[model samples]
Target: MNERLRFVDPTALMHLSRGLTFNPLRSAEVLDDVLAAFDEKNGYVSDVQAWVRGGGLQNGPCPTLPSGRIVADVTETMNAERKVLHAAAILKLEREAGIAPGVFLSMVSPTLDVGMRVELPMRALLKGNLPLEGTYTVYLHVLMTSDGRDLVYYGITKRGWSLRFQEHTRSAISRESHRLFARTLRDLTAARARELHGVLDERPKLRGLITTICATGLCHGEALDVEEAMVEKYSLASKHANGLNMIPGGAAGLRAAQRFKGTH
Candidate 1:
């Protein structure tokens, strides 16, 4: 198990990633034994198990997550490509995933349609171990245009999305966080030569800013897992060159979650 990260075997970690569904309990048990062996407390011992189960903190340009739209605001359109599926249609998806009815959340928007037609099912069953329901939320901070080329920031929170958005908002508005999300906001604010509040109010009206909910009902571990996957999928890391995230999702999000919710 310890060999998973060994530099000697580069393929070990890749093998882990390629395989879907990790046994968190198994990973946790192994890590516990390893940690006990060296009495290591502040290192990977504390986080590896969680990483194996879940994954990032993205206060992304989303860190500047301004007030944005939700399901209720969706403008039903005749276009079939962007429509959010109704719960009745989602019933089969929910039951197949073994989640309680209505727990698999799906959001809609013409800007960047997020209904079951797209990634709704992808997040839920990333790994066979993923639960259909839990507390934490895995979300995307999106900025898109009519071209639909959107830039995104990903983050997870047990806190209501509003409260967490405020945390990023406060940090970015003050220019305290240098993370990509904050930078994106500051850059936009600077570009318009306008006050932050005014810019926040303007972006959505122009249909350029969007806050997306990927999925809810994730337990701490599952949320982290999905967040990491989102970061990777969206290319949020700097190397991806298109994402607004400076840090990969999971560890940071997991650490924050541990602080707020404890390692239960």
Candidate 2:
């Protein structure tokens, strides 16, 4: 089994934008093992197996299947494209969770028409596994027009979309404050940013004018209106340039608005 494991070369640990690379035979073997476990222990359905059977090639286009359902018809060709589909699923779950909408979330102005279209499907493609942890990170690019409509490009991370914010647990505000009080607040804030983006995309009046602010170093101590959980998350983002900064402080409206305009 260990030999087979060695034969099952995992995907390379590298930045995603460079390109997609994989070991087909090894990947095939790993897929087989995963499918076997899903069936034997996870109680995954036959249809799900069918999706992974092809190594995910055949499963993605079937729009009829629900998002959370495991799939089997995995094809190397399909693996790359399925992120968007899965991301939409996670977005649906987020909406269902009924988390409070961030105060800063709002729509773009109708007269502006200044932004581009951000599709839900493409955003899903960015979802994949993370380097530090085996969790997923869903990446999304949102477009806000001056006219108060939004375009969002969303997807799972390249490694695996399941890697992000997987550890989030609901607790009393006091308890939540204590858990993240001393910890880095970047992840918590980024999660809030994503959540706000998800909601702003739907609300036409707000038009996708949502903003996220991330500050680190000396700035972390400064007071802000953002939730405590988000403060932690944003702090981390600033540290890595992986954080969100839509707030007026870190990056002013002219800069961020330009980025939205693609002029930056």
Candidate 3:
């Protein structure tokens, strides 16, 4: 109901659609409160219901036999909860067992290391988290400095962190760069270009300055869930505006991850 509610069943009040984005917290049976008040008097056949009725569909058996009827069909739905109480419970128990939380993102204290080994600690990310293994990792590109850190962008990746970092660096220098990390580097470089007399160097300037805060213990679906939550929390108003995200988190991540998985 937080977004928009449209259906004529008067009882098929699904909170969010199941097709657009998968809400891990949801299952079909948890949809509605039948006891909740519904205004039937104001309820009239919607455009969808009218279309079905126009087709002269009858509420017979089989699909209608034992009072079975299809009122409407919607394709896209998504939802998120901030409390994450249920997931938190399980993660805390995992922590007790010396396993890492399957969903988490936070900045690490800068090791202040320089040269080639500078990214080693950040690549491993959070310390004290065992079992740094998962198909998908939800990560944050944090702009780190001696003063403090700021979130630059968020993403999910199936490739190992080290490989993904290299992929991003390569993508940034490619002529037709459309990758998220590449785009972010382009944006940052452009900003710097203004001061450097219009020199748009797309080299990986962020190599040492960026620290990745990652959640490395979630399965594919769980990773999508956490990615969806992280993106919503730090979504850009416009592409390259506040962040480099061009799409909403959950559903899109699945498609991208699938493609990455196939390729690698």
Best of the candidates, TM-score? 1
Count of clashes, each model: 12, 71, 4
Please provide, for model 3 over 1-264, each residue's C-alpha lDDT reduced to its tens digit, 9 standing for 90 to 100: 322222212111111111112232221212112101111422222322333344322332111112222211111221264322111111113223322212121121122222121111111221222334434666665543222334356677765544555566567657367856577665554444443464555433332344343454457887878777777667543544456565667776568668879999
> Could you estimate the TM-score for every candidate?
0.42, 0.21, 0.39
TM-score winner between 1 and 3, please give it.
1
Cα lDDT of candidate 2 equals 0.29
Give the per-residue lDDT digits (tens) of candidate 2, residues 1-264: 324531111332222211223333333354445544544653433433243344342345422223342322322322454431111111223332322111111122223322212121211111121232333333333334334433322222324321222222223122463333112232333333454556443222222322221211112222222223342344233442433332332224235557768953
What tens-digit string does per-residue lDDT give for candidate 1 at 160-236?
55466567767867989977777665555344434323443343222245555576656787788888888877856
| Best model per lDDT | 1
Q: Which residues of candidate 2, in runs, are more than 4 Å off?
A: 1-21, 45-137, 140-264
Residue 239 of model 3: what lDDT?
Answer: 41
Q: Single out the weakest 10-residue window by summed lDDT for candidate 3.
A: 114-123
Better of 1 and 3 by lDDT: 1
Q: How many residue pairs of model 2 clash at the backbone?
A: 71
Q: Is candidate 2 or candidate 3 better by lDDT?
A: 3
